[model samples]
Target: GSRGSRGSRGSRGSRGSRGSRGSRGSRGSRRSVGHVGRVCQAGPTPSAKASSRASSRVDRGLSQ
Candidate 1:
């Protein structure tokens, strides 16, 4: 006479838990600029040519 007393006690302990996590996105922006300038102000003058000619004459005399 005990046929329907053990059918409702095995259906309340089978539930699983769930986990939730979030992710964040980050970005970086950087820029750099460099500038270099150079100026030259030295050249050969007429005096340099005259000195070179005199040296050449002296060398010719010595060789003679």
Candidate 2:
């Protein structure tokens, strides 16, 4: 009974860490998106190109 409880607790702890890592990754991506948006807003001609590149990057990220 002790061993079983320990195993379950270990699994839960690992899962929690994984969830935290995922959240951090999502936050990082959001930061990148915001930075890109700001840069895009700073110019007109480059904005269209940057937007296309950003969309492609988002697609790639989603695919992963």
Candidate with the greatest TM-score versus the true structure: 2
Question: Weakest 10 consecutive residues, lDDT, candidate 1?
Answer: 16-25
TM-score of 1: 0.31
**Model 1: residues with Cα > 4 Å off, grouped in runs:** 1-44
Clashing pairs in 2: none
| Model 2 agreement with the true structure over 1-64: per-residue lDDT tens digits | 9999889868765665456545655775677677666776675456545754665555445543
lDDT of 1 by residue, 6-61 (tens): 33322211111001000100110011011111111233334445544555455445
Q: Quantify all predictions' global Cα lDDT against the true fold.
A: 0.27, 0.61
lDDT measured at residue 25 in model 1 versus the true structure, 0 to 100: 8
Could you tell me every candidate's TM-score relative to the true structure? 0.31, 0.36
Model 2 RMSD to the real structure?
10.3
